[model samples]
Target: MKLIHAELIKLASLLSAWIAAGLATILPAAVAVLNSRSQVSRGIDAGFQDLAPGVIGAIVIGVVAVSSEYLVEGAESGGGRQITTSLTAVASRSRFLLAKAAAVAVTVALLALLSSAITLTTTSLTDETVSVGTADLPRVAGVTAYWILTALLASGITLVTRSGIVPLTFCIVNMSVVSVSFLLTKLTSWANYLPDLAGMHLFLRDVHGSVDIAPLTGGLVMGLWVVVVAGIGFIVFRRRDA
Candidate 1:
């Protein structure tokens, strides 16, 4: 409990978390508002599509949470990295990593929920024709789950690299409006199985040029990716020097 609380406090103290949260809340609504004015048909899954921009915020949350620990406070003063301090205090790498993961998961989940709610409400208000049916409730839930999973994925990758730049750049670029994965899907069918693309199938009603998997199956595939990557990260963190 102490470890988890400490991890939470450490995360809360970072400016990146607040910035990510703010972006997560505002970006989606702004996109929805702009989308409402356009007559172009964004297909049946427009709500989820409109909320896509907010995923960047979740990615940032995950990357920064793990990467911040590796940053040097003052190299000249020999302050060392926060990871050293964290490990010294906890004295158990596994426990500390788990605590950090738990803190990030909880924080990202709350951010996802709030951002999803805001985006959904704004989209509905702006475009009355956009109606969500009873069957779509599961997809709405899937959106939140997808955001959480993406955040975890980022966190795990950051742990392995011990640097935010690489993971952040790759994730953000791969998930952008004209994503490389999406483009590659046109040339190769296997590209659809990429983590981001497969995960998006969980909530997307009409995905273009991708494998057609059930929502539950899509979520499972994405979850499996997170598990594998995060497991590897945990192992490396345990064996490597702080």
Candidate 2:
């Protein structure tokens, strides 16, 4: 409990978290407003609808939470003073990482939920799209889980490279490439099993024209990936000199 509080404080104290959280809120809100204002003269565009503002804003949250560590040694939120404070508060490396991960998950989940609400409400005001409902809960949960795991995986990669810029750039490129591949129908079968794909599969149910992977399968793949990456991160963090 103390460790978690300490980790939460460390995260809350950082400028990066403030900036990322603000952007996470504002960018999506802005997009939702724009989407609401844009004319929908044609038919319902499922593709545009699937590209929800929350989903896009999550990309930034994912990158910053994971890669920010590299920018400030021992501080996932990125600041020298806060890093020192965190270390002084929590001596166990495993505990520290675990606490940080939990903090990030909680904070991001709240952010995602808020952004989703904003996007849906704004789009609703436009009358072009109906707000997502209980039927969409499973898919929304999946996207949130995927975002947390993706951030953890990014952290693992940062542990390996120790360069924030590298991981941040990689995330942008990887997401873009994945988005492009999603446009190819022939690949949806296997692509549906990919880490991010599983989440997207749930987000835009019509992407593959059907759910290729069951929701359970998607959750399992995402969970397993997080476990594996976190294991690797733990090993490296324990052995490496900080």
How many backbone clashes does every candidate have?
A: 0, 0
Q: Candidate 2 local accuracy as lDDT?
A: 0.60
Report the lDDT tens digits of candidate 1 across residue range 1-242: 88889989998899988998899889988999999899987778777787777889999989998999999888675978888888889887888888888888888778877877788788778888887557767777888888889999999999999999999999988877468888889899988777787888878878776578777877898999999999999999888888
Clashing pairs in 2: none
Candidate 1 positional error at 107, Å: 0.9
Model 2 over residues 170-212: C-alpha lDDT tens digits? 6656664455445444555565555666655445544443346
TM-score of 1: 0.94
Model 2 misplaced stretches (Cα beyond 4 Å) = 36-88, 128-131, 176-189, 209-211
Q: Identify the runs in model 1 with alpha carbons over 4 angstroms from their true place.
A: 75-78, 133-135
Worst 10 contiguous positions by lDDT, candidate 2: 42-51
Best by TM-score: 1
